[model samples]
Target chain A: MLKINNLSATVDDGNKTILEALSLEVPAGEVHAIMGPNGAGKSTLSYVLTGRDGYDVTSGDVTLDGDDLLEMDPEERAAKGMFLSFQYPLEIPGVPTMTFLKTALNAQRRARGEEEMAAPEFLKKARALAKELKMKPEMLKRPLNVGFSGGEKKRMEIFQMMMLEPRFILMDETDSGLDVDALRIVADGVNKLRSPDRGMLIITHYQRLLDYIVPDRVHVLSGGKIAASGDADFAKKLEAEGYDAYAA
Target chain B: MTHMPLKLENLPTRRDEAWKWTDVRGRVSETSAGLSVAGLPKFTLPDGITVSEVETDDLDTDSAMAKLARNFGGKVWAVSVPEGFSSDTPLIIEGLNRGHIRIRIDIAKGASLSVIEHHAGDAGGFVNVDMTVTLKAEAKFDRTIVHNDPADCVRIATAHITAWNDAAVTQHALSFGGALSRIETRLAGMGKHIEATLNGAYLLDDKRHCDMTSYIDLAVPDCTIRQAVKGVVTDKSRGVFQGKFHVRRPAQHTDAEMRHDALMLSDTSEIRSKPELEIYADDVACAHGNTIGQLDESALFYMRQRGIPLAEARALLTEAFVADVFDDLDDEDLRESLLGKIREWLKEG
Candidate 1:
């Protein structure tokens, strides 16, 4: 389970508050979606949850599986099964995709007191995952996201999620630059990882992504707070009617 | 002039324009011990090549270090490659540990040769070397310099090269710095249609210092030159790069580009880069670029978010930043070996 209670955050060295008294919860085996318009503090919430620097949490409490998530470093949070698929994936030149994957996986495993995966076994698992995602084997040999297209970067993020197998996943605008076919492929990859032991928090601006990956609950975030909450049908209502009614 | 043992005062100080960044006189003293004053370096010559000693005190350059080598080094070892001669194996020169050494290489017309020179010195020693290379028409020369000196050694190595028309020259250098070290090269092209490439990389740590300087003179038309150098410094260490391309008025069709990029890992680490292009011809294409920066923060965060630790993330990013300098090497084993050294340095940092 993941919980955020009265979470308020200030960005740019506390010059301005982006998240204000925000409260939410996502239980295991459930998928929750947060829908909001521009300047609704949607991305800031995700960044705060993942422990990115430069975001000061003035007053709030965030926990995963009853453990304090706010006190841990970003890597520690990641090792504790917190994953955030960035809205704009960064380009890391010179680090091969395969090498990056291995380093990430081994680090997480070591942090959890598990033995490192064997080379052959790791390669076998990676090759199988790449095949399932319809990614070329040669793509794994290139530098990580150095020259990859938007769609390819999204797919690579999902590929990493599958390989890491985190307990909680946060997808931040994963469908922004993807096309219809590419969106479908990314959706398929995400849906395959859904299980009763994992929790997911999907943040999107449009209901189009909801059509492919249905959510159990939906919340309308406005002015750094949740103005309304309902079932999946609420997403359709928000889509039909703009956020003007929910504005703070 | 009489032949006398060179004194410590003969070193250049920061007052010299060319040695401003690398002050050899400011660091060494008369009481510096463990000075290895030895004879010439051992060379493993391949077939079609011969080495003979010649007594010579006529140095060509005005460089302070080269003059020290000329005055201290009694004779110069001349290595000659006959006309139309070619070899599959590379001639290897053992590491220069101490003393002053002078060498000259001559590649006759239509001849080709490759040389690998290693520089590793003893503790508290000051090593100086002066080398000259002459290439005739259609001659090909490939030179690789590898420097891994002791942490307390002060060393300087200079090479002067002359190439004729239709000659091809390639030089690659990798240096793991010492207390204070400098590798300098001067190339003069005398004919048209010549091709030259100069690429190098340096890694420094633990207060070590290294300076890589090169000056290319293109005096004729239809000459092309390319130079790129990458450097990484950590733990209060310093790295320097000085590159210049001088194109004369007669070299109308000349094309040249020079670039120097460096990465500073620690706040205390320093890097000085200067890339210059002095072109007298208006129709030529010449460009120079220099950059000194830290690793990308966004890229570092991305790697860490994937569960890599801070140190490992930094190492991976740095290794990538300097890996492209050796991309054009023809030997796979040699490339891997060079990468191995980089990886080792990254781990230690």
Candidate 2:
């Protein structure tokens, strides 16, 4: 449902390119993985896709379900069912997670001319989802992501994604800071949410996460573009041999 | 030294030096009582505080100041702890005023109390209040000042605090309304082992203006003062903050710190801040900082990426920014009321 055609982008105007002629496609009902080394423009891809201000799209078109994504602001993208799980989730002090999540969910709903859900209904749904993710109810009582450990922060990201239930989500290095247990739990959360009508582009540096949530397709991103495409076996080989094979 | 025959010609309230930026003397001349305040809300507090003031519009300024300046002609309406009476319920006091309000509150010695003062008005008048707090030997006190009035009202408040030997005091001031508003906290540390924690937050919108000025004097040895002030400015609103920390030569072991941060929501919004530290003591720990900027774009992006709209994200960040001032409040009910006002202000901001 998401398509990137020869997308070349830079962090700023006339700056060094972060992504050069990078192109990828994730059809509906598919899960794609982009594995790359550090400074390999993995996060840049996420920023460019989400239309963050610093990322300048040099030459390319990003379309979501055949609709131009570049013309939309960050909030517009969110309204159109777009989500990005950041590598480092911001710690918003004094903003209770419950209040923040409801505001977000309702904003998305309001943009689509839907009625806002009552607090009781929201609490019911949120409490159930939080339980399934093994997140303590008290965690949601605190400020958004403040004082949460690296693992807890990643889990909260998944929790937020679950609450949004978006059509497409770009998870950028969500597994980097997570420990083994956290990775397993996070992988399970992602797997549980996978559906044929939804799409996700999982970006990471390692293939260990693949063992838990196997991808339908693997794209090796090197030199700012997808150099090779294959099945999950490609991920296994890349894990074994590293990016030297793709770099050459 | 002040009289209030509040004239409608003073619409913008910009007639005095302190009211230059926040002129409410001309634009408007009346206050609208919110639904909540009109009910004459009374807080449930401890320490047997019976403070009930009926607001009356007295057109004559000089006569009103002379009569109400000493607290409505009573026995100097003071709060005492019987030298050792300490109930942790937190002393709560409410004052009702319509036109010009003048009141003075004094806290007794060797006592500990948390007091919350709230001002709600709808008229284009003025409120001049003076609060003097004295901390006896080894005494302690904590105070919170909550201000929420419309753009047509004016509140010029002064607080004078003196901490005796081994005394500790903390003051938190939160302002969200007023046309030409200025709250000054002047503290004198005359006692050794004295400490003061001062924090303030203000939000200005429309053509609104708010000023917060503080002066803490370390007149004795081994005294410490800590201050932090934050503000959010929007519309064509303007705000000013001036903070000064002074340490005398005899205050050798003095420790003081002051920091101010401001957030401008609109391009035309204005923020002015000045921080000064004067220390003649040989050994003292003093630091001060001032920062002014717009909201964080990265944080906004991060919030929006998770399905939060821009406005919602901005409100969340603004709440977080100002909530820091209310951290030291020991009373729960008063804290919640102030926090609720903060939420409403951000939504309207």
Candidate 3:
């Protein structure tokens, strides 16, 4: 379970406050979707939760399983079962995808006081997962996200999320660049990871993505605050009518 | 053999444009005051290769260092590869505590040879090495030079190579800088249709200094050349790369590219590069690029976000930055060994 109480954050070293005393909570065994228009601080919320630099949290408390998440480093937050699917995945040249994945998995395990996975076991798991995701084996050998298509990049991000199996997942605008087929495949990957012990907060601008994953609750974010909360029908109504009335 | 006193004043100084970033004169004066010759280390040649000790009288007198190496009273060890002979085994020549050495390698027509020269010594002293490599028509030669000397020692080496018609020559050099280490290479392409590649890299930390200066001449028609040099400097270390390519008027269809990239891990670290092209030919493809920068911050953040610690992320990026230069080596074990050395060096910082 993840809880954010009165979470307010700023950009440019607190010059601009993007999130104004925003509060939200997604309990375990639930999927929450935050539907907001452009500049509604959806991405900022994800970054602040993940402890990325350049985002100053003005005042807020973010706890995961009753543990304060704000006091940890980015990697520490990651090891504590937090995963963020970036809106724009980074291209890390010279590091093969397989190597990066293995390192991430092992590093997280090590941080959690678990034994490192052997090479053969890691390879087998990676190969099987990659094949299921329709990714070529050679793609795993290339540099991470370098020269990959937009669809391929999104698929790779989901592949990593599936492999790491974090306790709390933040899908930041995961539906922005994906086509219908890619959206379906990515949604399927996310759907398969759904469980009673894991919580997911999906952020998107449109309601089309909700049809695939079918969130349990939908929160409309406007003016850096949750303006409304409703069930799955709220997403369809907002998509059909738009967020103009909800704008501040 | 008589021991000649080195004239420090005659050495190249920083006032010279070519040696501006490298204070060879000052370093030599400070370290070569009480330098003495140690016992020459013996060399064992691989099978099918012949070795002979020759006189150093025929060496070129282009610079003070070359002249010093020629007149230093050290016997020139020459290795010859007969015509049409090819072998995968590499001949290794090591300079362990040897004061001065002159090496000459001659490959006859259509022969192939590979050589690895390692310069290392634990005792604090001066090392001078001069080598001449001649490749006859249709010959192929590959050479790898590794310089890992003592922290207190000063090493100066020069290699002059000549490639005849249709000959292919490749040279790779890696230097973990010492108090002052310099490797200078001069390559000349004679006759037509020759291919040559000059690759070098340096990893330096602390107050160490390493300079790689090269001059390649494309004299005949249809010769191709490539030069890629990379460096990683941390702490207060300094690295320098000066490369020049000259395409003569007769070399009509020449193609050459030179690139030098460096990563400065610390603010105090320094990397200076100068890539020059002199073209007299109307039809040639010549390009040069140089960049000196720190690691990509976003890339670092991305790696860290994936759970890799800061130090590990930095080491990974640094290794990736210098990995391409070693990708051309044919020996997998040697390549991995060199990469492992690089990784170890990165961890030390």
**Best-fitting candidate, measured by DockQ?**
1
Ranking by DockQ: 1, 3, 2
Ranking by TM-score: 3, 1, 2
lDDT tens digits by residue: candidate 3, B118-210: 878555677777778999999999988888877777777788899999999988898998888888999898879999888988999999999
What lDDT would candidate 1 get against the real structure? 0.89
Using Cα atoms, each model's DockQ against the true complex is 0.83, 0.57, 0.76
lDDT of the structure predicted as candidate 2: 0.77
Using all chains and alpha carbons, the TM-scores for the candidates as numbered come to 0.96, 0.78, 0.97
lDDT by residue (tens digit), candidate 1, B48-75: 7899988986887978877877777668
Better-scoring candidate (TM-score), 1 or 3: 3
- Model 1's CAPRI class? high
User: Could you arrange the candidates by lDDT from highest to lowest?
Assistant: 1, 3, 2
Best by TM-score: 3
The local distance difference test score of each candidate is 0.89, 0.77, 0.86
Q: Write the per-residue lDDT of candidate 2 for residues B1-349, one digit (tens) a residue.
A: 2344333453334455544554544434444222111213235467454444434333222322233433322223344444544666776656533433333334455667666777665565456554556677777788788887666766656667777888888888888757767777878887788988999999989977778988888879988788889999999888889888888899998888899999999999899887899989989899999999888888888888766778878988998888887877766776788889888877775
Query: lDDT score, residue A1, model 1?
Result: 96
* Best-matching candidate per lDDT: 1
